[model samples]
Target: MIFIYIIVAILLLIGLLLLDFSLGKKNHRKNVRFLDFESTTGDYQIYTAGDPLFEDLFQDLRHAKKKIDMMFFIIKTDEISRELLEILKQKAEEGLQVRLLLDRIGSYRINSKVIKELNQSGVEFAFSEKPKFPYFFYRSQRRNHRKITIIDGDVGYIGGFNVGREYLGKDAELGNWRDYHLRLLGDIVQHLQSTFFDDWYLATGHHDEEPVPTETEGEKWIEIAATDGVQLEDVFESLICQAKEEVFIGTPYFIPSERLFKCLTDALERGVNVKVIVPMKADHPLVKEAGLPYMMRLIDAGGEVYMFDQGFYHAKVVIVDQQLCDIGTANFDRRSLFLNKEVNTIIHNPRFVMDLRLAFLKDVQDSEPLNDHLIQLFTIRTKIKIGIARFFRPLL
Candidate 1:
């Protein structure tokens, strides 16, 4: 009798969780905000190394004349991250109007005491996507995955790299972090600035005026695609559908939606060369396992897949036929497609696109081809992880 009672209680708890999860998603859909800005002219420099990226960014932070606004999905509570926060604090103390927004779940390691100190220091720190009532479980899973920084309304930074010692290639297990970031100085900075303010409004319920648009020397054009937990899958699908010759995808995670998978296969049928690269090892549990099925399907369809062995390949990039390129926070995964706020920049310049493709090919040269032997290396434990991961794919 007690065993039967226990089973009933477990079922009841699961039912309640499902109810909350469903309701949370429904509520989120009602408040969805999608912003697609037209292509604007900008000058950009790409950064693949962490130390140099932060070095230039920190220098820019110190040279800020007016205001500093920053947002990141994750900022670890390590020495490097603390150094960043200290810089922000000093800028704020100097009356530079420093505002920092962080995803609640991603930066949960930042304790309340630290938040209090940042606020006390005039940093105007706030957490986005706080897990609220009625569906805390589901709400917690939805994240703001954008990593952008706007300085003095002139320079802007966007891409996959986040603040952590690991991101600086300090992790013993995940040696030599590999990623991409863009430093922008041009009219395009205004668009990123506007997006940052919009997110800031969502988090704090406060509105601030935007700065004047800055002029650029470069003539290259770029478009901004910002999604609020919706539309990213369709965006990537459209990009892939337009590919005439080839498509190169690089992401840390590769769990694709059914529609996306079909689109890739269709591209393959059309003689488009589709190549994807994921990290050889996973930094998170179950993520690599969840992607195996999709990887296998792509391989079966004559598409190519590579496992980046040089380091954890965290670059979220897509290059189509050397004509277009996208670089930003959105991954080729469901979390970026349907569960997180993401931002990506679409570049139409052939020169920039080719440059990115070259760098991608270099990374490919450092990676190992995913073949039968690699698949055979999956042990029983991995098989179990794959089974569990498939069951929880959406949340992954």
Candidate 2:
């Protein structure tokens, strides 16, 4: 009888272990391969400065007729946040369905009082994966690092703008903030709207009251690529492999996995022109040091690297062969390409490519080339930090 009980206990333990592994595997596979959104043509505009982006966002919110769905990584107690909160509050009061999803850890600085007021005013809000001490490693680490807005399901937004004064360059310490955002219109908006509901459903477990899907007519080649960081590795490599002439990437950080790094260097070996632009002013201090090894390796392999001096270049975009353009919230770093949830819009329109190329050139005018000499000047203490940074690249 005692032997039978022992055998039962061992089997139960094994069953529990297998269950945990299966659940983890399923969660990692949550990143769908591709969006089956209806094909449509629409006018897409790129916003590089904070002032115009903020103005356009506020206007969109005010013009919203039915619903407003917004998700962001950070929401501070800055001027912009206050203004946005006021607008969202007003909209909720006017009976427009307003849903907000924020990353709890990213927006930790947000005032509890403001959140309470918004809740009382009928602004439905919830933080994505609110951090807990026991489950900090896996659960809280995978943040909804995506920033998107679906206004009335007709207009859509994707890119890297959070509600903060730093994005407007208002903070002297961070200097002038330079970021990129996209204002999209068309049936493609419907796809993005539904994408928001996916996260909303996970956070709240009920999406019956989610924003209504809206579609429109069009004829452009725009595809939405969603990722939880694992498949993004393949998407980027495949995208780079298709480049014929040149590949230009603009990102705030550069911390890709080893395999992806080889893809770029290999492309360079084939005489393809490869250029990358990263910010001189790092929002995260250690990030600048962490990216040095990758920078040096790329430069050594005949690839070019540039440091944006105008301000913090927080734009994550890629243009391949002047024909293919991809822009969204995913950076070249491991955090965006491996750990966090991110989205990028892939467009095959020449007009859109030209627009992005022009913006890249304009930004280049404000950038200075990066070389080995600059990287070697770091003190031994900083080198120690770089070594530590390399070990924790995925976490960054």
Best by TM-score: 1
lDDT of 1: 0.91
Per-residue accuracy of model 2 over 1-396 as CA lDDT, tens digit each: 999999999999867655654454456667433434544566578888889998999999998888899999998887889899899999999999999999888998766787899998889988886755433455556677889999988888988888898889888767888778889887778778777888888788866554455665556778777776576888789888888788999999998789889999889988899999999877885788789889889999999889999878998988998888888989998888766888788888887798889889888889988886777677999899999888667667
User: TM-score of each candidate?
Assistant: 0.97, 0.89
Q: How accurate is candidate 2 locally (lDDT)?
A: 0.82
Error (Å) of candidate 2 at residue 145 is 0.9
For residues 1-396, what per-residue lDDT tens digits would candidate 1 score against the true structure?
A: 999999999999989988888888898899898676888888899999899999999999999988899999999889999999999999989988999999998999988999888888899999998988878888989999999999978899999999999889999999999999999988889889888989999999998786556745557888888888778987898899999999999999999999999999999999999999999989988999999999998999999999999878999999999999999999899889889999999988999898899999999999999988989998999899999999788888
